[model samples]
Target: MNEPCSRLAGVAVHLPETTMTTAELEDAVEARSPGVRIPRGVLERASGVRRRHIAAPHELPSDLAVAASREVLDDAGVRPAELDLIIYAGVLGDTVEPATAHVVAAGLGAACPVFDVRNACNGFANAIDIADALIARGGHRRVLITCGELLSAGIPWRIRSTEEFFAAGPHYTFSDAGAALLMEAGPAAGDGPAGGVLATRFSAESAAWALAALPVTGLSSDPDGAPLGIGRFDYDSLRFAAAFNDLDLEVLHKPLVEAGLRWDDFAAVCVHQAALPYLRAFCDRAGIPHDRTVVTIAEHGNVATASLPLQLAEAVRGGRVRRGDLVALVGLGSGIGAGIVIARW
Candidate 1:
């Protein structure tokens, strides 16, 4: 028997009402460390993020996911009880035990097989990949993957000096947001590649995992452990950027090769956006058309695992992507991993 095609059935996103501008963050930096000589506009110039959504202190990461999940479930007209599986894929969670997926499931009153998938920023894309496989092989008819990222919670608001500023700068480039995507089995009522997910490819460079992290060690400490405590944003952004200096285009080429498609074939490509410059650089390195890609880094900031779908939602709403339109989701996250999911919207 042939594998049943799994397609993106619905998508929804939730952004916190609060916002923090780059200039405001810079002001806070200078206010906290008066002696530091961090220049204004430098942060925005480098990060390409002007502002980002911020969750309220009372909001938990699970809340973000639940909000979006409810919207998606309603949009898809699929009841919680009808879902075959549920996956909470994100970097932030309410706690360590009980699995964040369970929180999301309970929030929606969903009673089905559920789990969590955490791969730093690539969590959502990877979750979609896993759900696609499960639907194709496990006979699960409907799978929901949700991501809730409180990336701002990791930001070290108090900087002591310029050196400290640059090292922790990566923390400021993100915003808090929730995203939910529904994948359903079987064909659709469109002309999109005979229905949903067409191809997916994943690659990892584990050795380069040290590029960035916000570790919370229980009993032990890392060799280069973050002395500042949890959410330290312990990474040298400069070295990390240089690591991708020699980026090979194979991350993208392999997908096209396997799926028998071309770069131009996609209506809009949604690449992970930790920052605007990196997104642009990756596109340039991959030779993908500049206009063909969506730009959310500047406005949304990096929404972490929710980044791809947020951009995708914007594209579809704006008419840049239509039903049956072919779209590609590219992910590049801290674990130093990459993945591409080709689906017909």
Candidate 2:
């Protein structure tokens, strides 16, 4: 049997110092939109987000990604020159051109190939999937995946009406953060209770793309056919949930079962978390052990593509998981896409 060719070497996260509680977001909503009657504690009850971090005024997405990438690289004792590829997979970038990966590579003084992979919240996981294949091809030896999400900056502050506020509530729970993962090519480890990436599967439901979106492009105040204006967030949590509920993850879970791994077999399971309730619901529905997973949405809000890596970092920091343990990564994103990545720690 062919062995797994790539392994996750290190993971790191960087969260902005400033934080805003759900209560504060509600207060701001009322303050910004005097006409909108926002009942106190509503956002907190609905989203289950206690607070989230906010980036500094001068902070850019690349800045956060660079910080995390540097930390992970340093932690693994890997130098910038040793990297073969740098992929920035995040929701936002420093600018449209030059690719966010270029900024990250520039910060690391790396001259290797750099690119961007944008797939909503699934960006980071998608990069991992692609990097794993690249390493398997025997070309790239070391790959760096980074994401710096400054979603707080794009939050819709000015509310036109109560309906508009609720439709855009997902924005209020967003938090700014940066995360990175390092992967290296190594001797093959066959699919089993061994180290390295064991299996991966990705699925998409593009038909549900309009369930949630934010049109914050700094162009014409509002682009044609766009969902909202500057800082405008449009979301429908109910429909979003329904869409994902319909998403078929059998392909994702089949390999794990075939490998004789159950949910309890994992030392830690990291799933993309948007809200506390949604996280719990998804876990319950998927039969995932919630106790073995780190809950970040309640305290950290939704960190977008950084969610999985942050959970892994938190688990490692807390000593809940260690080397040689089996772990699983489940990714659910705004594209209504889902993916599964199981590996040995």
Candidate 3:
């Protein structure tokens, strides 16, 4: 007998109502940090992000996750009680302990085993791989994977100097959003309308992890009355770009090789929502046509861990992807890690 595999049953997303255009963000930067100059169009040009949603101060990651989770369950025609497992797959969570999945599960009235799977930006793809394994090995039928990003929360509003602001530049491209996916055990490969995951591979470059990092600093009260604590992100953009291209060339085709397929076999490819230039470069290096790729970074910015699923959902809604078409899901996260999943839609 063939191994049981999971097929994507449904996908749903939620975005905050507040939008900050690139121009507006620059303006805000000027107002918040006087004397620091972010030239017109520089932010958008650097990140390829036109605008991004900002979560309300009171909105938590769990709230966004629940919103998307409810919609996905409805889309899949499944009840909360029907879920055998719930995995919160996001880079940020509601708190430091007890697992963010617990909060999301409770919000959705989900009575199931709950946990979290975090892999920076590759979270959604990683969760899918885990769910597929459980369904195949443990006989779990239905699983829910949800990710909510409060990316704006990490922005340090009060920068002490131009260098500090410059270090945070890459973060301007991040947006607040949530996405969820419902997967269930399905017939073997080529047996259903919702196709099974044909192959998935995850790789990491630990030595290069420090190339991108989000570190929290300033725990003690400051005499200047600034916030007691703040989150700061740093990255070597040039190094990351070069490393990303090299890694793609090395492993982007592993899944295809493992599955004995070719680029022509996929109808669409959903790469992580990073800068447009990086996406274009990756596609070019992989020999994938521009028309075969889906990009959300320009419009939504990078939604962090929700990026992959959000991209996939957007492509489906836009008709860029269709049932019976094979698509590739590629994820590149700050962990300096990459994950690829090739599936038939």
Candidate 4:
């Protein structure tokens, strides 16, 4: 049987102008946890991230998505009217009432079908999978997949414990960014990209779901008491880090093997930017070249669902990726979910 096929038509990305450095994060963490000690250099050396971009106080996910979608359409020479579908894949939403996709689509002047995919950090890969399916089914000629993450909004400023963790090196590294990819059916009458969608795989260890959960607990206040919002990261996140690290390898192996390829077959691998330590451990276990693995966590921290696409966009913009290269998009995050998509671009 022939493999499925899909092709990337175009790509574009946007990063906020504001940046937060490792030292700044450390100071913030220190202020929250006076006794906690973390070496700033450890963050940089381990994460390969020097700084991360953040949105302004007034900016929302839809705002970033609009900017990014425009750039992508312009680069692809595609007009808003030409888009058949728009999928916003990210954890952050413009509002709890209305889907952020509607707002972003309107902002982009797109008068087409629009929706969202919430798969945490793996959202982009999941979006790609959905777009590919639509093209395969001949239901859509062009599908626009966009992701926007505003991770800073979730930070608890009031709680010293939560505040310190946000101030920690990882938090400073966390950034706000958006990315868009234009995907269309392959040149031939096939479901896969011309080069082929070799294989796609996903895995999850449900028992480990609580590893990186955000519980809706009461606020943790800074020196000046103020009501910090709900949803704070559980410090015990470190405990499940090991489980995710192990799952990363398990997830990649299945698709790779089914595709009759090895880790060395791909020119580059785009994994979710969870954190510095977990990423390193995954790389070491997989035996994939660390240099080939794109790192964004140190700078962008963990952009939840937007991380993978943002990393892919960076690699493309930096000229690190080119035509006919075997690229892997791997996603791992809450839900303890992990997915892999092999793409030829």
Per-residue alpha-carbon lDDT of model 2 for 154-252, expressed as tens digits? Answer: 687888888877777788888999999999987686544346887888888888888877666455455555553355456777888889888887856
Models 1 onward score TM values of: 0.93, 0.92, 0.92, 0.84
Mark the regions of model 2 whose C-alpha exceeds 4 Å error after superposition. Answer: 1-4, 190-194, 215-231
The residue ranges of model 4 lying beyond 4 angstroms of the native Cα positions read 1-4, 27-49, 156-172, 188-193, 215-230, 246-248
Q: Clash number for every model?
A: 2, 0, 0, 16
Q: Candidate 1 at 124: error in angstroms?
A: 1.2
Taking the tens digit of each residue's C-alpha lDDT, what string does model 3 give over 1-345?
877778888888999999999898877877888767666887687778999999989999999999999998988789999999999999999876799999999999988999998878888899999998999885699999998899987656666666776677787787999999998888777735656887888888776787887765655565765554445677898887767766745567766777788777777788887788778877887777787777788889889888878878988888877787888888888768887888877
The C-alpha lDDT values of all candidates are 0.85, 0.87, 0.83, 0.74
Give all candidate RMSDs, comma-separated: 3.0, 3.1, 3.3, 5.0
What's the C-alpha lDDT at position 140 in model 4? 90
- Index of the highest-lDDT prediction: 2
Error of 4 at 324 (Å): 1.7
Measured with C-alpha atoms, the lDDT of residue 93 in candidate 1 is: 87
What's the CA error at residue 263 for candidate 4, in Å? Answer: 1.9
Model 3's alpha-carbon lDDT is: 0.83
Compute the lDDT of residue 58 as modeled in candidate 1: 93
Candidates 1 and 4: which is better by TM-score? 1
Residue 123's C-alpha lDDT in candidate 1? 86
